[model samples]
Target chain A: MIATETALALQAPQLMTTPPLLTMTGVSRRYGDVVALQDVSAMVYPGEVLGIVGESGSGKSTLLRMMNLEDTPDTGDYRLALPDLPGNLFDLDRFARRMLCATRIGIVYQNPHVGLLMQHTSSGNVAERLLIAGERSFAALRGRAREALDASEFPLERMDARPIELSGGMQQRVQLAKAIALEPVLLLLDEPTTGLDVSVQALVLDTLKRLQRDRAITMVIVSHDLGVIRTMADRVMVMRRGRVVEQGLADQIFQDPQHDYTQQLVHAKL
Target chain B: MTLASLTKPWEAMSYGFLDASAKRELRRKMLKAIAVPGCQMPYASREVPMARGWGTGGLQVTLTLLKPSSVVKVIDQGADDSVNAASIRSFLSKVSGATETWDTTEATILQSRHRIPEERLRADQVLVLQVPNPEPLRPVEPNMSVARQMHADADYGRLWLILYEQIVRSGRVMQGAAYPSLVNGRHVMTPSPIPRWDVPKLHMAQHLTFLSAGREKRLYAVPPFTRVEPLVFSDVPYQVEDHAALTCHRSGVSGYFMNEIPQDDGSSAFEVSDSHLGIKTIRQAEGAAIRIGPTWYENGKMPQ
Candidate 1:
């Protein structure tokens, strides 16, 4: 229902320069009696970071999952504007979806355990996506892994160490390295640093910001932490009870929140 | 009680060493497995005369389908006369009154362990491969229930991850035998411990292949014309062993899979892994009118 956000802050002039990467309209999802999301519409433009900030159970994670095709919407139009793929993602088969997800988009989960194979080495984790993407030569995989790990500020010495041997910060860095290793057009992140110590959170965020700039990747991040959203997002969407309450550019939303929930979130964080 | 009454009444043994009910069960499972290619169907792998791991699975399938008119061939690692192969061949013949044959062309029902015959199986032939471990997901997920669920979901990401890791660590997918493959493009199946060289023989081939793990109580099939594709990145093509260029020391036959025999001084000797093929080649060279069936690999390569 057009509850808020009449004009997206991306600006029409800038929109003319590049087409949107993902667009969803009237997307809804339910789990039995629980309506996780309802009539949520959003668009992700190229090379920009869009953040969905809401408290837990506000359907932010659900929206993020739908973007990654982890869950399909019950009723709505969800399309991915990838050059190689047709406009409507739902029209493609699972194999096409898998290929698109593996090669064109990368995702980092909240838990390092979910994002990584525990038995594999840290660099091996980064090399995993490339391997899946059909990079055959071990030398090429190793070289790319080294470069990505270095870009994520991971130490070269511990490249071969298992995930359990590294700290939470390092594990997140490995995840980031893997997510960016394929140089994907889009990256989806779900609470990438929530479990890390507050002091260590900035390190992962900094690495993410640097990777985003270097790769020019359009990113969608969902989190309950306003600080994370403020530090990373170019545009922000404030959601409440499965609907978008307010959305605009990062400075506009933070400096002058239109919705009461957005105002509350901004004030509590400040 | 009378001595004859006290002694148990002599009941005749069932044909093929299995009762009709057990054979019926296996036949049902086989039909289902063929209907849904590559999907492992659970079955009651009845106890057989042999040990649990040593070709018991193949023996059960052989016994199930065995008949007086059937010609059975048993191969242990491609050696027709291996002790295990010889024992199983004789046991099958002893129970079913079937003719035992070492010639791949003559085999109506061939049961093999570790290696598939180099001779291409015909449409009328059935290959029952003995499986020690049935679950291809065993390396990734240890829990069988979870593994079954993973298969149901087509969640083969973890399997691909293992192949990915192998490349990262060892510079290649070091999975030598029981290479995991996608059957009919849906189910990922382990084609038993047959070498990577032989996996292609199952892909869209004329013969039907049944891989059974009696110890694991599971069986799966690759019906004729079913796709059996090994898991490899599109850029990284599947590679068989580098035995094509090597010639057999005994038969002087080249362009087939070979066994490496290490010497005391470090030089190795190469022998054709298929002993029957080697014997046939040697006999043909001696002009004894030996007939060799068409091979899967021609000139050391599967005709692409």
Candidate 2:
């Protein structure tokens, strides 16, 4: 068994007693005439990676955006059942939503250019998020940024260099560092390894898995690649168009997919 | 719309010489500049009565922050009596109804050209330095977009190469005024043509500083307690101009920066570069009770 499984096994009784970290019911969104998501209901338990896989126009990005609060759904009931938070997260005011987005939620975009500030130093990009979250001391900010970059396996010397100087793979690592610097409760990643080389993708995936295992962070990873889902996810949700086609354990989804679209996807991969 | 609704009041001039919307925009940009020390924040450089290059950038900033109770000070190359300085100072007071002072200690806002005040400014003061050229990479890369990309990439290798070439040709760095310095250890900025001697005064200064360029439409800040280090190689130490030994001929003050006056015969007479400091020294010598505040340089050397 993997380290995450071993850790989960150790905390099995406590995990059973705790509530799901996040719950969404009947979430629907539309942009003009086109529907992005339709009547999607999902629950993400604590300390687990929930992978969403779909084709190009399959509402997966839209779903991740709704979760990150970048885009609001037309109708939904979203609840964050953490111990410290009270009431439904979807009912938060504009200011409260901003606060939660800034402090509690971290997101990694598919394009590193979108995720990281191109003009800012790697350390500066990481420190920007911490500064928004009210970390004032320059020493403390730099310290935490350095720690995060180290965890992401970025070179310590290049922390002062800007994003333009870094390669595509390095920029992605910097983005990961910036996202996780706050040690947020929830992480949302959309097509993180899509544009990266195979070797670089492997390295990024390894660093991400190590970080997730170390922090036990609840995550929603959206990807079109079934291989990525199989490697990273404990539970897989297969999406097509604007609906969930199949949802189950990673092994079951890979070995015995019941839905036609999922079976086609598995066969194509094989 | 009715004529009465079109015009509210027959006021002579707007408060602080800028419209309310302009002030609001500048205020927002100023906050962003302070939040990211040394990062240049772009803004709409508003129109003023003065020409674009003649302290218009500083004028806009002063106008944005101006109030009736503010004490404004304007100086050109350390002299308050210069035509540019006097005109800007009068214009500021006339527009905002604020008090004008030559004393650095009494001023709440000090807008200057080419030189910082000789006296140490308090924490309450805001220094606005007029900049002709804001980009330090202009010497290395002529294209603005490429320069911006270089800035984004933190690729300053060419800037160091320029300095290295200067050292190779002249046996020392040839940069005189507006020496490029690294702000907050991230962004390199040209400190607005202030002499090398004046550059050290900005390091970890108590007062907030804004460097604005009107034509460039860019403004950056150096917040209080931020680092401003001159770029220099360890092998060759950074050196200020050798004006420490020169004595001011009129004020009889030694160790301060001085302006060299060529005499008819073949001799040079030195006068204090900061005219206000010289005036105060002359007053004190004439037995007038003049209170001179603490200076950045004490007896020709900055305090360690």
Candidate 3:
């Protein structure tokens, strides 16, 4: 399985040659004078994980929301450089945006209950997204749903088990399965493991890491934990007060911090 | 007062129970309903002899369209002999002097509650379905005004949320009847309380269908050749109850929708839902010259 995934990913010089999947510049948003984000700029490339780390109210979640097309930037040039689509994604109509959300983008919230339908069985949650994307054949739906649950390492016997009946860790597993079921081109995570126990957090993190590697999927993750950012992120962006303090390679940011806030964050982690 | 009242001409009731002006108003609203397929048009539902919420809307439409020569058929859940069906059929005939029928092919206007006929209706036929509720968005949005706005915007994406909840819990969509379907690709309307089995018969059908609710005071139409597609995820296709392979206990006919009757033993017996179709089959076998028209399904499968 690992061999096939590695062969399919084919991490080579061409990965560096591929264009960025999403690009944003000078994006700002405010709600009645409460500045959530101000002039935040970033670009996410293919086969890479971009981490945004900040404290609460730092606009990290807002940035991730814009990346997933859930919210639009008030002032910026944001383009979803998908090959088939033209122009800025924010300019697209409601129906087009809905289609994009149903087909191309996947998001996992910090609270598993928010992302997953607790009343649904594990496989049913995964298959719901597939059905929205217009899968009709029962054999194909059942086959793909089983494959997704197996990929997330959910117990096969408990496929019909509801999320509410499962443990906290298993609930997170169901969200992961649903997020990856559609094979979304871009996956977004909002503090995916903030509330889990340390031991279970490690397990979910390991599964996410494997999925990211095997699927060659581009992801933007928002979290306050530096350790999580270091474990999953190829490149890191630090945010403080709705601004990017500093961004660079994960090792460079941790080893040789330039900005004062970056230095403070990196030292605080130690 | 008694002398003047006695001198005045005696009258029993208006023709067809609804006045000529009431009929004209219904005709205007129904015309508008058909102009934009599946869009519900409000009408002034007048009081009839029968009570409301009991196929009164269908009764009004059939009453308006009935003439001396028109042949009308009425059924309540596919049973013509049921009290509701028999009463409504007799009432319609008595009011308008139209011929009543139990056969699908012999009727010009077929008024039904709960189930559509199994046999294929001809292009000349009109199917009047009694609607208990017409708004597909009622479950999501209770406010009727808000639902109308939602329909105008064609923002029914949230309807999937209901099915999504069901699918997640049961690993399948569990809605058995009144399935929400999109008509003419613009509006999503509930196909009344018809079974999931009978819904397919309305899709791009040659015959026209009108679903009316007298209490709700709304009526919608599915015109001939209009697309009536059930709202379903592509992966999870809409499923009907499993009655395709079962044979009817009395008529011995296979490959049609059947009602299950549990026996004293551990097993179950099946009977055709369309009571008239079973009667026709039994009579034809007994050497009676009866013609059963082509059905929507053949050999237990709806032909693609």
Candidate 4:
């Protein structure tokens, strides 16, 4: 038994060295005359957290939106490497994009209120994702919702409470629970902890870290706060004026930023 | 814009009283509303001849779905002869060139306020219910934005609490009308002021139901065979009003909802609430050979 356990543990790190799960090349999105994102290229590996940092209107949201398939890029190639199907998601039609959004991608908005359906019970909110994924049995839906909420450490008794009744922190946690309920291959978060209190921010970050590690889920997190990026990101990308300025390992980017904008960002955060 | 681009050769009126663009928009919204049963889909509420609060929502939906061959029945609190019901019915037929009906059995489309017809709706029929208030959480959370957020979160704990409080205070569920019900086990929709007896008819029913609120600019649907469970604890089952055993004085019809009339001598006389049903029963009794259809409630009891 000791030999088998040792072998399994040795194989785990080898799995981390696998090929990238998603890769984008020269992705550009424009709204009429204004460019939202231009020539933004990046890669995300399996079970890794990629943090994107930029000021407001830096096109960080536009890049994330493209990655989420909520908006299509005007020009670029986005290849998502799945186990069975590794194809360009941008090439798919609107209905296909919607299907992918339901089955493969899960997103949590910056505003918890936007992420959640305030009228539904917490379990109902989670159950909706499952229902969209074609789960029909009530028992199965409820069971999965309960499991996800439990994993997120949400109060089991208040699972039926609406978002309006819960605190801002609890609403964010419910959003997390709802997003992870589907067990998607990719999870996207936009300004997840911006409006949260300091103590509640720490708790939410802690919960997110645990979920990422335990589930081995790949993630793309967009935030302006460097502290959030430093704590949670495996890699970091800096953006300015709708363009990628610099990209590197989290420690390298924090310590030795190449671009002046990135250096100024690092200094400002300090 | 040029006159040619802005205007067309005018006719007497648009078919179904609504313009083509209005009908198209409603059609799109109705499809989405049907797709996600019980989730309120927002739409642009168009102008109709009737006042805003007076069944305009139902009228808009009925107009959108109306055809020349369609037979429509409008009911106000189970009575077809009421002023509101009669006017709406006449207006619908006059505009669409369709037939107006008082028989639930013959109606291709049934529009109602505060009631569902006693007769069981069939698979082919569509029922449009006028909703004064679309939000079920309005009582608990007054803020519309917060209520919307709660709806998005699927949080309905306060609703259950309200019911629990009602039971504790009144010894029974005192909510007499518009009991909040969970639709398709997901959304807690206000079944549009429907009596408790009528709410159960929506659960796993053969026909489709659309509940629209014009003032609120929202609409929802309960498609055929969807589950519509009334909010209730396991220990306390839902109880409809006790009107099953009372017999109607004029038509001698028993085992249905009734309206009570008080006598000057301090006595009470009951009449069938569904006026058309009462008329049909009376006619059948007088040997006119009218066919009374199968009802949702059988022999004063709704089957479990």
Best by DockQ: 1
Better of 1 and 4 by TM-score: 1
DockQ of each: 0.17, 0.02, 0.15, 0.03
Instruction: Encode model 1's per-residue lDDT on B158-226: one tens digit a residue.
Output: 676677677766878899999999999999999999999999989999999999999998999999999
* Per-residue lDDT over B1-304 for candidate 3, one digit per residue giving the tens place of the 0 to 100 score: 5887868476587778898899999999889989999999999999998899999999999998888898999989889999999999999999989999999999999999999998999899999999999999887677889799879878775577567657756778888899999999999999999999999999989998999999999999999999999988656778877788999999999999898899999799999999999999999999999999999989888887
| Per-residue alpha-carbon lDDT of candidate 4 for residues B78-175, written as tens digits (9 for 90 to 100) | 99989999999999999998899999999999999999998899999999999999999897688999898778767676676556545444567889
lDDT for each residue of candidate 2 in A1-270, tens digit (9 for 90 to 100): 123322321233233566778787778899999998988877788888989999998899999888888777888878787566676677776656766876888889998877876765778778767765656444566688899999989999998788899987899889888888988888889998998889999999998899899999898999998889999998888887888777877898899988888899999998
lDDT by residue for model 3 (A1-270), tens: 122222322223243677778778778899778888887778788889989998899999988888777888788767777777767888887768867877888888888877776765677678767766767555566678789888888887888788899988888788878888888888898998888999998988898899988998899989999989999999888887887777777888899987788898889999
Task: Report the C-alpha displacement of residue B206, candidate 1, in angstroms.
Answer: 6.6
In terms of lDDT, the poorest run of 10 residues in model 3 chain A is A1-10
Q: What is the TM-score of chain B alone in each candidate?
A: 0.96, 0.96, 0.95, 0.96
Q: Which residue pairs in model 3 clash with each other?
A: A120-B168, A135-B234, A135-B235, A136-B234, A136-B235
Instruction: Report, to 2 decimal places, the DockQ of model 3.
Output: 0.15
- Please give me the DockQ of candidate 2 compared with the native complex: 0.02
Worst 10 residues of 1 chain A by lDDT: A1-10
User: Which tens-of-lDDT digit does each residue in A1-270 have in candidate 4?
Assistant: 123322321222233578777888788888999988877888888989999999999999889889888888888888888765567788887656766887788888898777787866777777767765666444566678889899888999998777889998888888888888888888998989999999999999999999999999999999999999999999888888888777778898999887789899999989
TM-score for each prediction?
A: 0.77, 0.62, 0.77, 0.64
Candidate 4 Cα outliers beyond 4 Å, as residue runs: A1-16, A83-85, B1-75, B85-252, B257-271, B279-304
Off by over 4 Å in 2: A1-17, B1-49, B56-74, B81-83, B86-273, B286-304
Model 1, range A1-270, lDDT digits (tens) per residue? 234443442233344477777877787889999999878888888888999999889999888878777778888777778667756675666666777777777888898898897877888788777766767565677789999889889998999889988899998888888888888888999999998998889888988888888778899998988889989999888888888888878898999897888889999888
